[model samples]
Target: MRADAQKNRDHLLAVAGTAIAEQGVEVSLRDIARRADVGLATLLRHFPTREALLDALLRTSFDELTARAGELETSSAPDEALVSWLRDCVVWTTEYRGVTVLMAAAIEDPDSALHASCVTLRSAGARLLARAQAAGTARGDIDGSDVFALVAMLAWLGDQPSLAPRAERLFGVVASALLTSAGGS
Candidate 1:
């Protein structure tokens, strides 16, 4: 693509990501094109289909989350790193319910790029889980997939404002349940 075309495509992806996260993965291509101040043809040129656009959006999110997780690895405290990951997960779930759901769904589809992204995240999450488990700050039996499932449920719960307190407590509860210690947990 040309420079301007690439710029427009980038803008469309940004708008589409925000739209999908806020509205749904089911959002129309025209809707994203309109939001991006681009024509439908341009949107189509960038993302040939809903599935393709979704794959791109999920990949972008995975990039961000993975980068965040990578940064956490530099932290000296494994427990703190786990907590940070949990917090990041909660934020993603709460703010982007549709995208979060999309992410979960993507993991189920073998051919999806989103599935590839999930694999990367799952691997990183497993490493973090191992660190915490080794430190006795979390359960040794916990699998990364379980963490994924819990976060998916939390994301679904994120839309309920009345459940704000419970929403906030969800991560802590899960963390406590995973911990080997009694008092601190």
Candidate 2:
């Protein structure tokens, strides 16, 4: 891509990110174009679709979270790593309102633009969960898919106005329940 095109793309992504964070993943594409001071045709030429735009915006963060899970696997205790990754995912999901729904759907639909990133992210969390389970630190009954579902649930809780205040406390409770040691040996 030319320097100017890249610059325009970056600006669009930045504007889209802010719009999604403020309004949600479903925020108007026309609004994003207006915010970026670009024509709607320009935005569409760059992104093509809402999913494409979201994938472009979120892919970097997803990659980082996946890499972070890998680092935590080697650097932290199994249970600690799992809980930390879980917390990070929930926090990230909450930042983009209504993203959990998309993530959940994307995970189930291989054809979705977000599918690959969501799968990789979920797999990263699963590895941490598996490591904890192997060390007898986490419950063995739940698998990676369950962990993914829990992340969606936790993020959803964070999105709820009535439950937002209790999200941190509830996260602690959920994290504890995931770890066997938290319940006393």
- Runs in model 1 lying further than 4 Å from the true structure: 182-185
Residues 129-173 of candidate 1 have per-residue lDDT tens digits of 787777777777778888777777777767666776687677678
lDDT of 1: 0.75
lDDT of 2 by residue, 1-185 (tens): 99999999999999999999999999999999999999999999999999999999999999999999999999998998999999999999999999999999999999999999999998999899999989889998998999999999999999999999999999999999999964321
Most accurate candidate by lDDT: 2
Q: What TM-score would candidate 1 get against the native?
A: 0.87
**CA lDDT, every prediction?**
0.75, 0.93
Q: Please give the range of 10 consecutive residues that has the lowest summed lDDT in model 1.
A: 176-185
Clashing pairs in 2: none
Backbone clash tally for model 1? 0
